[model samples]
Target: MILNFFDQFCIPNLLGVPLIILALFFPLMTWFTTNRLIQNRYSTVQSSFLIYITKQMMLPINITGHKWANTLITLMLMLMLLNTLGLLPYTFTPTTQLSMNMALAMPAWLMTVLTGLRNQPTASLGHLLPEGTPILLIPMLILIETASLLIRPIALGVRLTANLTAGHLLIQLTSTAVLALMNTMTATAMMTLVVLILLSCLEMAVALIQAYVFVLLLTLYLQENI
Candidate 1:
């Protein structure tokens, strides 16, 4: 039963080759292109959203970190599209995979750390120790801080994976219950259907929010370094 519940998360295959690669790139197809001089509604909305999100994300970053603006925005959009599209029937969500999430998290976190180390070594290293520390507790504090620093990427990945996974499981369970009750308990099934709809909407919001959070954390890490 447990295996059945988790089976949906497994990487889909075609002729023994993983379809996750296709899943990863599928979102790109949904992106709006602005090739025409007179933009259509889709292109206009896409450009406006990009501009707004870019402004918001750049507001907190310093000039030195502005170079990361494009990378961060592109990542956020990719994640948002992947997560949103995953909610569709017969689609896979790469973000729900821990390995994929960690792959995204680790590089972003490492880049921030490296930026800090390269640009401001003393300040970055200073983060490992708080000011006015007791002499005896200094060593212990340094160890704790070091542990926390190293755990950032893991935390980022786990948070995204857990949230999306839990939401997907809930939606699945609710949907299954609705289907099971439709014949025997019409009224109850209707109620369950309504709940399922609500859950779907909430999940969509979570999908976007989690992607934003992932990038926001990366931005904060960069801010600390820069």
Candidate 2:
């Protein structure tokens, strides 16, 4: 039963062929593109929304970090699409995989850290310990700070994995219960189905929020470094 419950999260396959690669790029396929002098209504709305989000993300970043705006915006849209698309029946979510999340988080996080160290070595190292540390506490504080710095990527990956996993598990469990109860108790099953519907709605919101939070944290990390 447990394995069956988790099977949905497994990388889906068809005739021994992995579908994850297809899933990864499916979101991009749905996007509208145009080269006309004026975009159509849907294209205009999409462009405006993306621009708004890009501007908001860039607002808190330093001028030096502005160059990353396009990269960050692309990531945000990709993540948003992936998370939302995963909620569809029979679809896989790459972000729910620890390995995949780490692959995404580590490079981005490391790049920000490296950029900081390269551009402002003193400031980056200074973050290891406060300026007013006591002589005896210096080593301990540095160790703690260093450990924290090293764990940011892990934290980012785990946060995304845990939240999506929990929500998916909850939805799965509630849905199974609803189905099982329908044979014996119609009214109770109906109530459970309503709860399941609400949970699905909540999950959609969580999908978008988690994606935004992920990008927002990266932006903040970039801000600190650049």
Candidate 3:
């Protein structure tokens, strides 16, 4: 039963050819492009949403960090698409994979840390130990701070994975229960179906919220560094 539950998370394959690559690419296919004088309503809405999110993320950072607006915006869009797409039946969620999340987190986190070190080494190192730390506690505090710094990417990745996994699991279990009781308990199954619908809606919100939170934290990290 445990293995069966987890099987859904595994990447699907056809004749030894992994189809997960196509799943990862599927979100990008949703976007539409046009060179006409006027854009479609859906495209216009997408552009506006991107602009709004980009402004919110960049507003807190200094001028030096403004250069990263495009990079951060693009990353957010990719995450939003990937997360939303995963909610579709039979779709694989790349962000649900720890490795993929870590891959996204590590480079972005490292870039911020490196930027801080490159621009102000002393200031960056100063972050390792507080100015008012007691002499005796200095070593311990430095070690703790260093560990915390190194753990940022891991935390980022794990937070995303855990949230999505929990939601997916709950949805699956509820769905299975509804299906199992459908024939035996018509009234109960109808109620369960309604609950499943609500849960699915909630999951949709979570999908978008998690993506936004992930990118927002990254922006905060960048803000501290820049």
Candidate 4:
């Protein structure tokens, strides 16, 4: 039973070919276009929103870090699309996998760390020790800080995975309950269906918010380095 519940998170395959690749590919194809002469309402709104988000994200970091603006913005959009798409029936969400999330998190985190080390080595190293540290506690404090620094990427990956996994499980359980009760208890099934609908809406919001948060945290880390 437990394994069945987690099967949803597994990389689904059809005739030995993973669907995750197609899942990612289709979304990217839809998100980009070659048209330059026309603009629709949807495209206009998307452009405006992207511009606003880009400005907000770039506000904290120095001009030196502004170069990262495009990369971060594109990443946030991809994540948002992947997350939103996952809520649909018969779709696989690549972001829900820990390996993928960690792959995204670790490289971003490492880049910021490397940037700091390259641009401001003394300041980056100094982060391990506070200015007014007690002589005896210096070693302990350094170790603790070092541990915390190394754990940032792990925390980022775990946070995204746990939130999405919990939400998906809850939705699945509620939906199963609704299906099971439809024949035996019509009224209860109707109520469960309504709850399921509301839960789906909330999950949609959570999906977008998590994507924004992932990029926002990366920007914050970049701010520290720049």
Q: Write down the worst ten-residue block by lDDT for model 4.
A: 28-37
TM per candidate comes to 0.91, 0.91, 0.91, 0.92
lDDT (Cα, tens digit) per residue for candidate 3, span 58-163: 8888899899999888888788777766676556677889999999999989998999888888988999999999899999999999999999999999999998
Worst 10 residues of 3 by lDDT: 27-36
Candidate 3 segments exceeding 4 Å error: 1-3, 14-37
Clashing pairs in 3: none
Best by lDDT: 1
Candidate 1 on 73-107: residue-level lDDT in tens?
99998899778766865567878999999999999
User: lDDT per model, in order?
Assistant: 0.88, 0.88, 0.84, 0.87
Q: Estimate the Cα RMSD of every predicted model relative to the unseen true structure.
A: 2.3, 2.1, 2.1, 2.0
lDDT of 3 at 191: 98
For candidate 2, the C-alpha RMSD (Å) to the true structure equals: 2.1
**lDDT score at residue 130, model 2, on the 0-100 scale:** 98
Q: Enumerate residue pairs that collide in model 4.
A: none
Residue-level lDDT tens digits of model 2 in 1-226: 3448888888777888777666656545655444446768977888899888888888889788899988998898788877876687557777889998999999999999999999999999999999999999999999999999999999999999999989999999999999999999999999999999999999999988899889999999999898
In model 4, the runs with Cα more than 4 Å from the true position are 1-3, 28-34
lDDT of 3: 0.84
**Candidate with best TM-score:** 4
Model 4 per-residue lDDT tens digits across residues 1-226: 4437677777678888887777777755865753645788877887899999899888888899999998999899888987776686666667788999999999999999999999999999999999999999999999999999999999889888888888888998998899889999999999999999999999999998999899989998888887
